[model samples]
Target: MNTPLPDVANSELSQALLPLDWVGMQGIDIPLILDEPGVDASVHARADLYVNLPMPQIKGIHMSRLYTLLDRFAEHQAVSPASLVALLELMVDSHADCHSSQSRLRLAFELLCKRPALVTEGLSGWKSYPVVIEAQWCEGRLSLDATVDVTYSSTCPCSAALSRQLLEQAFIAHFGAGPVDSNHVANWIRQNGSHATPHSQRSVARVRVHIDQDAEHLGLLNLIDLIEGALGTPVQTAVKRADEQAFARLNGENLMYVEDAARKVQQALATRFHASDVSVTHLESLHPHDAAASSSRRGTLPFQAFDKALRA
Candidate 1:
């Protein structure tokens, strides 16, 4: 028989002999079966899988092993908390030589749902909501988290106030203390009402939450509904004249700033979900940069710090 080649990963030693906090792949493009409970069809998703290396002498991790295990799991098991636990257990067992104990998975995909127009008859179009699910297993305990990005329109309260003041000034100048005739006022307003309209811009809100331990199913759809309902003016598709007019009325009635958007989402999620964090970013049309605000439920840890710690 011919001489067999030796495996360097297991037999060789590291040149520096130091352990790494995290050593694995990122941005891995793999197709996964996203089978949320109660959903009719499975969603095809892109995922990233990783594991930590805690041994000082091990040359490198078995990258292929991680990939193979993830592929098998995706092929067999539906994505859920229980499946995440099993996958992390397999990851730890696969690294017996290195004594590794941590594993992570991230999946990103667009949730496609049919949304009806504000005022349309038998007309609906698909709206895509960007979603991300992150799971981590550390020291035998597994945790799951998810985030959804919702885009809506936000009107600046300050800008609205300034616009109203300017309009009032114009009206006073035009009337000039004459007997205010209804037709004259109506004609003036019809012509000049929109001349000083408030500026509104497209805004985005990213709502993230830690799944409750006792929950049985994923809450992606529910979370999206909650945020959209609270905002009261989500971006729409399949719009006609009536729908556009309805949208304009909504913007006029529910004027809000970035801070208002964040608090609205935070409160909406807090009342229903166990733990939640909300970040609202308004792409200001009048400013060079976007305005952002972040909020969390009462007595909950700050989301920024917690997010950093989880990644670290």
Candidate 2:
């Protein structure tokens, strides 16, 4: 005689006759292979996978099934737009008992890439960009949202203007009333060229874009390039004296406020992606608090929800 295995989920009955909007797993650690093309990509991503439990009579959805489904997907498919959509589809299909109508998956990981020094020949270093990809299938339509966190330097325009004013006063005091000799003025400037340098601080920008459903690829690298390029002052990877000088010139030329940085990113993303949300935070060197601003394309995404998603 042989013993039969028991299926607890199939046998169990619900204590409360109510359905849950989302029920499954949260923070499932998994290894995701990213096929970004021409790169050796691998990430240990923390994923939140869930499906709506719409059957009130069922005790609970197949929790083990949900986990196994995700596991299978992770093992077989590389992380991409098409794979994500297919995984969600499988997740919803597996929960046939609950009649699951919607599924959501969120993955958080850091993407590493080699960045070349701004001015040094044959010099490069690695940089990590924190990324989050969220996919949802509801009402028979799938939506993909991606967020990237990029760091850069921002010089305060107001602080730069104030520093210029102080320098002008200092120059007037040194040069005196009428026409001073050119050699004397040049000497004074050489002595105090940076008498009043503007205050600059390291800032972070979080950009979220709603990608078109049915997009061939996630386009993570391209999105990153566009955002970093728009800002024009990404934090460097490898730095020599020349590289540092180049960085200083960049900061001096692209002086902007927190709001200006946000709008610049928002406009650039809107032009490229057509729908995006941008939020920038300037960790001020002079002030104790940080300066921040957020913007979104009109009617693309609700401001409150988009801001919350950025924080999440």
Among all candidates shown, the one with the greatest TM-score: 2
What is the total number of backbone clashes in candidate 1? 0
Each candidate's TM vs. the true structure? 0.88, 0.92
Give the lDDT of residue 131 in candidate 2: 90
Cα lDDT of model 2 by residue, 1-312, tens digit: 578888766788778889899987889999989978644488889999999988887777888888998889888999888888889998999987679989989999998888899999999898899999889988777888888999999998998999999989999887778888989888998898899989999999998888777777788888888888888999998899999999999999899999889988987887777678888999999999999998877545322257667556
Give residue 68's error in model 2 in angstroms: 1.8
Error of 1 at 93 (Å): 2.0
Lowest summed lDDT window (length 10), candidate 1: 301-310
Name the regions of candidate 1 deviating beyond 4 angstroms: 1-3, 37-44, 176-184, 298-312
Query: Which pairs clash in model 2?
Result: none
Q: Residue 2 in candidate 1 has what lDDT? A: 92
Model 1 steric clash pairs: none
lDDT of 1 by residue, 1-312 (tens): 699878899888989989777666666665566556433335667777777788888889888888889889878987777777788889878887787888877777787788888889888888888888878777767777788899999988899999999999999998987789999899999999976989999999988788754466677877888999999889998999999999999998889989999988888887886677788899999999999998766334213234552343
Relative to the true structure, candidate 1 has a C-alpha RMSD (angstroms) of: 2.9
Model 2 scores a TM of 0.92
